[model samples]
Target: MKKKLSLTSKIFIGILLGALFGIALKWLPSGTLKDSILLGGIIKIMGTGFINAIKMLVVPLVFVSLVCGASSMGDVKKLGRIGIKTMCFYLVTTAIAITLALGIGKLINPGLGLDMSSIVTTETVIAENKSLVDIILGIIPSNPIQAMASGEMLQIIAFALLVGVSISILGKKAEPVKILFESLNEVCMKMVGIIMLVAPYGVFALIANTFATVGFDAIWSLIKYMFAVLLALGIQGFIVYSGMVKSLSGLKLKPFLKKFANVAGVTFSTSSSSAALPLTIESMEELGVHNSVASFTLPLGATINMDGTAIMQGVACIFIAQIYGIDLGITQFLTIILTATLASVGTAGVPGVGMITLSMVLTSVGLPLEGIGLIMGVDRLLDMTRTTVNVMGDCACTLVVSKSEGELDLDMYYSKEENNIAKNA
Candidate 1:
């Protein structure tokens, strides 16, 4: 007899087992099973490996897909139109996200009553140099090869788009380069498949190590702050995106969300827009985003698509201020909006950049950065949710932009296709 399980079943099993083992190790005493074998070794190793494997695929996948996207765009005006549309979408969505977060944070005042002594803070000395100029300059790589060599995704993206656009001008000559990259893109996706096979084992170890010593007690302690941030994400995902879809696309939200649901799940697991860009782009295209529009919008969205995170940052900052009993004036809140948006440019592509940006936000509003230490314990956990929202936001924006540009597949966008059969069906 052969045993075959559904994809959802497999993923659920991974999540369920990881959660169970994690809780056991965290709550139970220092038993041998929890220490060297279960908690100490296997879980941490697997989790780190999984994260690294996913990250390793981020740069090439983004570069190649974007290159393919640009090469497919036969005109400069299309590229320009797409870029302007994507940027507008990103900026507008980001502003909306922050406003929603800030509004809720003010109303809820989660930080006002929380006890701060219960959380753990990492004391690693970090370099805090962040500015708009540095981020802007970094986008154009001084050396393209070095950018790729160092995994500088923005720079790699810039170089790839330039090369891709120039290929169109070459007429017949660009064929060889396009063919080579298209083949490479296929190879990179193959690698993602191989990496995904180990996902369960990776998730198991990661969850185990993360929870082995993680005191849920602390989490329960700051449930108020967590609730505020989570509630904000929920509102943005449910209310805001729904309104955008209904008003802009004139499409039913359920069917649309159903199509790209898997991409959102993957993004939450990865906590990376760039890592999730391929799936996002694919999902968008399959769900009717025209190739030129998707190529233009999705890549740009991946680079600056921090809407969910920005919302969380704003809410988290306000909550911290309340907890610290720091009163911020209206000007300070406006300053936060400026800093948050500006910080996003620097925060993109940097490992663990959210907290650093949060630190900047807190500092701008006169909130204690020490309060970041309080939320640090739960950041990774909440990151899962925010990442989901980020990917979903990108998808929503792609749909609307493509629609407005007259590049959307209306039939595919509205149809609900089965997971395994979607591509062929």
Candidate 2:
């Protein structure tokens, strides 16, 4: 019998072939064949459909999974502890990510000797700053229905968590509601499995379209800046994440990688952590993380855990400062870290959120907001990569919390054979 390709293997093939196909389009004569038929006709349809499909699942998946997670937590005190630990892990890692990015950016000096005189910049009007108190106050939804409609992740998270806790408090009185959420969670997971069947094609379409449309010139121009951001992401993913898994959970890194590849691929293709939450939760559960932990932590992590984005902001800040010949002091560096960290939480679920938060960080430290144009061309590719890391951070946190809570299934976690069985089943 011919062997079946693992989802990971299939996704890797998709990425490779997609890049090749895109580059091939660039080599073709610039005419209707390249511009109109391939890009405008086929690629747009497939890519848009795939993205819309993934996004369609986000709100429902987050709400159902989180509600199930919170309701399952019979011990409310432990729920509080889990919340604290998850937030701490996410924030600390984000701080570490930025610090690492700055060090890498400075050592690489991506902006030094780079010609920016030809690059055009437009003056941007920075939004009036809001107080920290106002930002915190805004998390509570004035209307839960509006929050859900708008996909306001932070507000949705807060609301879902509250509803879950209420059900738990009501106990037997809320049994019907609890059962309904549990059923809905299963339905959502089923939808995830169905949606993922289209992922390889979706991935192929998205990547090919991006490369074909954007071309390589934009990427090559900012190669150094891209390298620094990618390197920092690599360090965070392999070194930081690997060390956390080994020390915190005592799980072998090999199995984790084996499980995470498909999730990473989806995150890379979609460039949206919220869209990737369902797969992240699925992979975590298959890796023996209890549903409660996976559901609760992954949803929250998708909302606020942005280590990869933070790294990009850090590198971009340094790169822009060097280009403009601006010197940053210790106080300014501290401010960048603090601002980026807080901004990650505040800016959750916003489109083009990375650049928005980067703008905030820049404005905080007296950096020119117009400098954003320097990195804009390459942000799409970097966004895809950073989002993969963001989802990975969420899964890592899930594992860590499961370990502390004694929710990890050691047998399932260790048995590679079970992976095949689960998939086959």
Candidate 3:
């Protein structure tokens, strides 16, 4: 009897085929069939549809799963403790990511001896800086419905946590509400499974569209800068995350990566952590992270855990500073680390948001904003790579928190049969 291919294997195939198909399109001569019908018409619709399908699940999944997780915690203190641990892991990892990027950036010197004439400088509008107090206050939703409508993840997380905590507080009195949320959570998970069935096709369309549009020329133009960012992302994803999983959770790295590859492929194609949240949660559960931990940590991670973005900012900071012939001192380097780390919390888990936050980091260190425009052409490809790293960080943190809190199922984590079921499911 022949064995069936797992979803992870299929997704990987989709990514590979999609890249090749896209490159073929990029090389073909301009025509209505290539430009109008295929790329713009079929590819665009399919890619957008796939992204929308995933996004449609994010708000409900986060709200419902988080409610179920929080209500089931049974102890507000444990919930608070988990929250602290998760945040610490995210922040620390982000700092380390930027520091790593800085180190690599300095060593690589990607921007040294660059041709300034080849660079295009576009106008970049810097968002008005917000105080820490403002960011903290923004988390609390005055009207949660409005927050949900706007898809404000931080606000939605805050509201769901409150609702979950209240259900726990009321105990038997809130039993019915808790039951409803649990049912909703199951439905949402099922929804994730159903949507994921189309992921391979969706990933193909998305990746195809991306490469078809962006092509390799842009990447070659800033090859050194791209290499710097990609290198930092690779270290953060493979070494940093794998090391943390081994040291903190005592889980073998291979199984974790194997299980996570499907979600990582989706994340890389979509370039949006928010879009990949459902799969991330599902993958964590497959790794034996209890939904309570996966629910709370992954959503929060999606919002604030941006190791990948911080890496980009770090490398870009160095690249930009070098292009402008600016010598950054210890204080400026320190400021970039601090600013990028904190800015991760405010950065939305979407494509190109990192570029905006990179502006803020550059501003802090007195780097010219026009330097951003220089790398804008290649940011799309880099964004996809970094988003994969970001989601990986979220899952790794979930595993660590789940293990420490006694929420992990060791049997499930190590069971090949269970992992097969999860991949097929």
**Candidate with maximal lDDT:** 3
The models' CA-based lDDT, in order, is 0.67, 0.74, 0.75
The global Cα lDDT (0 to 1) of model 3 is 0.75
lDDT tens digits by residue: candidate 2, 1-425: 99999654565566667767888886788899877888777876666665566556656766676677667656535578887888789889999999999999889988776433232132323233556665557558899999889655556666877888899888999999999998987777777667666656766765675455445543453688999999999999999988997898887888789889989889888888888788888899988999988888998787768899899999998887766666776656766777666555533443433554565567556666545544544566688899888888888888989989999998888888666779899
Model 2 segments more than 4 A misplaced: 1-78, 115-221, 417-425
Clash list (residue pairs), candidate 3? none
Question: Order of candidates by TM-score, top first?
Answer: 2, 3, 1
Q: What is the Cα-based lDDT of residue 399 in candidate 2?
A: 91
The candidate 2 region of ten consecutive residues with least summed lDDT is 117-126
lDDT of 1 by residue, 93-126 (tens): 7888888889988888776644442222222222
Better of 1 and 3 by TM-score: 3
Q: Determine which window of 10 residues in candidate 3 has minimal summed lDDT.
A: 117-126
- Error (Å) of candidate 3 at residue 142 is 28
- What's the ranking of the predictions by lDDT, best on top? 3, 2, 1
